[model samples]
Target chain A: MAREASVSEVLLDARGIAKSFGGVQALRDVSLTIGRGEIYGLIGPNGAGKTTFFNVLTGLYSADSGEVQFDGARLDIGLPHLVTRQGIARTFQNIRLFANMSALENVMVGRHLRSHASVIGAVLRNRATRREEADIVDRAHRLLRYVGVDARANDLARHLSYGDQRRLEIARALATEPKLLALDEPAAGMNATETASLRQLVESIRADGVTVLLIEHDVKLVMGLCDRVAVLDYGEKIAEDVPDRVQRDPKVVEAYLGGALA
Target chain B: MTTLEGKRRDPRVALAGTLLLAVALALAPFAVGAGAGIAWVRVIDFALLYIMLALGLNIVVGFAGLLDLGYIAFYAVGAYLYALLSSPHLAGAFPSLAPGLHWPIWAILPLGALVAGAFGVILGAPTLRLRGDYLAIVTLGFGEIIRIFMNNLNRPVNLTNGPQGITQIDPIGIGGVSFGRTLDVFGIGLPSVYLYYYLFLGATLLVVFVSIRLEDSRIGRAWVAIREDEIAAKACGINTRNIKLLAFAMGASFGGVAGGLFAGFQQFVSPESFTLMESVMVLCMVVLGGMGHIPGVIFGGILLTLLPEALRYGAGPVQTALFGKVLVPPESLRMLLFGLALILVMLYRPAGLWPSAIRRREFAGAGNSPENGAGSERE
Candidate 1:
């Protein structure tokens, strides 16, 4: 299901990525390639190292061994902010919005890397800073509208419904204008209607030419919406292929429902 | 659409309301009797100074979520900077630089702020990784270190004049107009306290303006974002280290300016002035008023500063009325009442007397509201 253009040009490529915490090997030799404009899915049972792999890819946890290449350059996974500046943005499994800030301000905070206003500029409120601030507010509003949360733009993120908070988090991530956007369990605790809208939102996001790599628990959602799906079980990739083939793989089935199925 | 519309107010109305409040505050000194007016002005002057300190601390604790318990160190640095530059002690210590050139308050103000800011960055750089209680402990230690240095630094160099402190500090004056003396303006002789009041008011207004501008800017948003969630803020491309340091430096600069003013008004500087209790009092103002809210902090500063003084005045009369004879001295009763008031405020209004709207909503604990559920579905 990968598009022809995406197939030829990979956006994110991880090779032999591994991480360990003390004696526990959280991630082991996980490798994957996400092409430009493709919606890649990562799925695994609880404690299967899916999140650990995401953390390594996003530079939250330093990989013990491996290299991650984004847009054909060796990604220097330094600080999380530096990784974001390199054009990869991510959301958390547990939504981490700036709860005290308004929805618009939350998105504007996402524009921090792109904006050039300094403390002096802010204190002085110069013409350039004012103009840039206006642009930020306008862009923030547009992003809120894009995520269908514009009506709640003035509302505090914490005051928003759980589903709206998820959407707002996505909007904030999009405000970074990333080449690759990663979502971690975006559909968790969402109703069927909310999940359907989320799927559509992801499709629209991909249509905007932003590549997406998502970790989801809903196998049906992944199978239906993803261009390719990768299955992880016990810190290793058990299957990586087009969603239909990956879903039918014996290892994937066994990982989901015990060894008796295998 | 209805909710958004409901939240909107006419800009003109808000402007008018603010202008009216400013006018009332400006005229308040003149409205009182002469002696009471002087006393009121003195109270207001200290209140303004405390407001500046609280605003500065707000940047660190309220905006960046850095619990700083030793913020008075910066205040002490500013005061001592002013003291050293504009006092005879400098000449007394170094005879070569004798007839020590006393700098004008205007000149010393920025220098004090800059020196305090430098110290702030110096203190902040090492403790960037420490959060919450650990950060508080480091800052508390930093404050005590500055105080101890001020107390004992008279031996070799006589920098701070030991426990004797630096005195004979020059009062601030511009040309013929001196803030320390009564000035005849249009047939009426204005008290020096009135002049000090106006000076302090102007300084307060400037700090308030700067604080409001910073609160609404990208930097302010970054600080608040860091405060709310540092990990998420960093992932969103905010350099948390630099931002947190900036918060400290900016906050310290304000404390420095306030310290300079304290030196000028009192014409004295002592290590005893900048104690741990002083730092705690300023933090209480921020917490009791409402953290991160400018108007609330200003109100907190004024209320706390004046409350103890007010209690001191009323204690004797109240004690006489209650017991027919004074059982406790007014000074002791004042502290007792002040402590009781703080305890009550904390117990009843933990968020603050006047909390920021976000804080109010957070403490309201209505996250699972049905209206929000319906609102999300509408989107």
Candidate 2:
């Protein structure tokens, strides 16, 4: 609805996306457009292809057939790192921080795609490399601050409380300076207080001029945070409209509600 | 200034300890000679050499988490480079492997490193693509191939002495000073032990420094990143395959430098010394020392080397006293005990006795590092 009602630029337009596992089609002809600086929510039942869509968009897995366009650039998403470098980043459904590394280091890794210092520079510990490294460290700290994780910078990422890790993951992704970010189940295990914080955080990311593609199961959270919503059931998009319309769509309710949500 | 920021106060303590050790080593010649004391000095040299090799292996297996079973190949290459350069045996054949080679030992040492590093790239290019178990098997095969090449391959042209190995390698001489025979230095007699012992000590320190530095760099971070979670590392823009190959090439060169020093010190190079067991022994050092840890690997290497030598002498007497005959000799019981100990360590402390702080957490419990801990939270 954000793009359909506006004349602004499209940051990411994913069309006719399809994926399969052996004989099962995990996703089928799913399509969604995320306008620049907007929060787009993708919703579905369990195994409704929400993560499959995120995986395809983030380059974790290639779609069997589809087109992913980010800033008008075609994306086969052959390599996750390449997609990340093209200014698209995402969190895993399960958190994936570098365990032994300090939280600061975890965020610094996000700055890795940005640091182009060569092997020779690193091996010799040259001045340019040192400068680059210091810059990255500073940016990493700044990013940690943005996510409210600055106090935990010295802590090993694994040692952080669950809520903090999710926040840190968002911070790490932001350090990549992405134009579009996909967050997979960021609130899956959070308490109400933490989810409230995440909602604010996502809003803040959008306020910073980056588009968001969200894979979330919490319909209430989606309805509150997203400007537009896309619904998938059994690998196909059944509804694409404002969250209110998505909630009222009979096909979506039949596919997901089974009965009224408690 | 590096990633080891937690090391400031610790390095000062280490420097003091190293100074104390250097002083004791300087005075050791007075304790005895030719007897077990001289043998003890030789034992320290071997330990230091093993420490260097183990440190390199640690970078590959511990830091990069790429299990290598044929690390001895680099050792062989370094020894051969030293032999071909410092001796006339293969000098008549491939002179580049030997070179004008009249450069100082310090100069040749780096060349040996380069040669070994080059080979590391060669092996790692194809093999680093393999996983843990497959890498181990391939490395084991590579080690055997080097040993076999060293053992055979004699031609109409004389080179390597064909199982006879290279003998009478010239020891390093600085200016006009001879390091081969004993001499006087600072009122203390400079024996062969003193010459090579200091050399080995210096090399060991260099290895430790470089390994620690490598572990913290973008390269080191890339390695640990891969080790902890490879898919994530690559997703983070690390070329995992190339990063793994870098780990291999970098790790292998340490073995080369140690091999070169060994060749110079021994004044002989034998194919037999570069055996499958030697590789296994170094692997054990990394395992025993605590993976990806500099101090642990050094201590582990020294302890492992000296324990057998100590047992050799102690075993003869203890067995004689108990059984009226030698019960288990050092060579036999040492290995049996070594094997059993690794088994026990793996079963009880799978991470190691003193693993890298990160690896300790990686193995200790469920996912402390959110990414790596994913599957571990299983029933």
Candidate 3:
């Protein structure tokens, strides 16, 4: 709410987005406006199109009809790498680290778009390429330390603890230096302690000036952390307001209760 | 970890190791001469060529995880290019080309590699959406298509000279030193095979160096990332399509250079040399050694090449000695033993004889932790 009072500009404006998969409408006219430097939470029950919207925003799935304008320019819908290049980095609900690479190497891979090393430069190991590679390693190490996974820098991603792996994924996403960091279920399987630390980490990331769009099932965390919250049910945005107001909305309550009387 | 050993080794130790390796390689033919016929030196030369081919293929199948079963098509493209440019076949087919091109070795090598790389890109473009088994099948079909084209291209235009292939191709030479003839270096007669061995050794070393450089570079990391998980790689801002195409082109160029060297070494090339079995053999070398590890891949190539030859020589003698009469022909017996060896390796060492440290850890840590995630890594 402190950040919401100062929120004057929108970082991401996705309008009239719709997606369907073989007779099932996954998302319908779903729109979202995330403010700069604010933690925005999207909460929904099972099959409420929360993930579908995330997928469409991050370019994993093409929207049937929509326009996403991020940081002023219109975003291309279905090219995932381009989406990352355009300053929006995302983490999957199921962690998708490069399992064979070291944690440090995984973060270095995320720094790929920021670095400029051509094939000739790589094969020759020119001075510029060497310097860039060194910078990449240094940055990756710092990111691991930031995510509290520096001790596991040399460990393969698959070998990391589940909570540590989640942290590493966040570190990798941060390596992209995104204007918007979209996390899909960052606290999905964490213990209470892990979730608490994750909440702090999210707060720190937002403090670093990167806008965060969180999709979480933990209602308490969303209410406590988000400056504003949006609720989706049956492919529609039922409520979008500050956490207190959205929490008290009768429509949101009915939607969460399966809308039996609707 | 052992992966960092090469970078962390003492300079003196590394230099000494290199010198020792050079001495052993320089004397390898003589060492073989002491035990067997000099023809084995030619076999070793071919083995070096195969090492180059295997390393190249490793980029596609091992590093990028593209599973290019049609890799030999690039080799064929290079060999045919060298043959057409360096041989009198072109003149025989067309009166306008009476003098023939007869391009120099330096010009032909790069040209062959470029043409072959272009072919690689051509093969890679449409197959970008494929992975694993489907990619393998498409590549297999592509390889056969090239072979069949070479076999019948003599009809309308005598480019490949039909199945008979181009003969009397020019041998590679440099400044009065021809690899086709023996040379007296310091009064120690270096036979043509030994000379070709040195040339092929230098070429293989260059290829090895390139492969090493590629494996540790940013591009190499992108390749390995794609191999590990394509979707994850894309999420990390890697353009998977371009990276995949680059792998194909780079891998094919190496194959092309090897093919050109092969033509120059044999002074003749036929469609028979570029068979599906040849591609399978090179792939076997990669998988048998260690898919992505350079030293492992080199070991795999040498072992596979020499093991079959060793079996060929020993099979007949052992059969006659054991039974007091010839039981099975050495040719068939050699293949049988080779197949048995491959099966045994796959059964016991599914990660290969010398897997990369990462893969080795994966196999070792399998089922040890509930969060191992090894189940998703069943490649």
**TM-scores of all candidate predictions against the true structure:** 0.93, 0.88, 0.97
Query: For residues B1-379, what per-residue lDDT tens digits would candidate 1 score against the true structure?
Result: 1122237789999999999988987777787435475687778778889999999998888787788999999989988888888878788779987876578888888898888899999999999988777889999999999999999999898889998888888887877577888889899888877788789889889999899889888889899888778778877988888998899999999999999989888989899999999999999999899988887898899999999999998899988999999999999989898999999998888788998777777677665431221122100
DockQ versus reference, model 3 = 0.69
Q: What are the lDDT figures for the candidates, one per model?
A: 0.86, 0.80, 0.89
Tell me, by lDDT, which candidate is best.
Answer: 3
Per-residue lDDT of A71-159 in model 2, one digit per residue for the tens? 88997576778888888888878888777778888888777778876555666678888898889989988988888989989777888
Over B270-351, each residue of candidate 2 has an lDDT whose tens digit, in order, gives 8899998899889888888787777778877987797777766676788788899976766788667767877888788766
Interface RMSD of 1: 4.0
Worst 10 residues of 2 chain B by lDDT: B370-379
Q: Write the per-residue lDDT of candidate 3 for residues B1-379, one digit (tens) a residue.
A: 2333335779899999999989999889899877788978988998999999999999998888888888899999999999999988899779898777688899999999899989999999999988878899999999999999999999887888888999989888877788898899899888899889889999999999999888887788899888888877887889989999999999999999999999999999999999999999999999999888888899999999999999999888888889998788889888999999999998898778988777788778756431233224321
- What order do candidates take by TM-score, descending? 3, 1, 2
- Pick out the ten consecutive residues of candidate 3 chain B with the lowest summed lDDT: B370-379
Cα error, residue B187 of model 1, in Å, equals: 3.4
For A51-113, candidate 3 gives per-residue lDDT tens digits of: 999988988888999899999999878998999999999998999888878898899989889
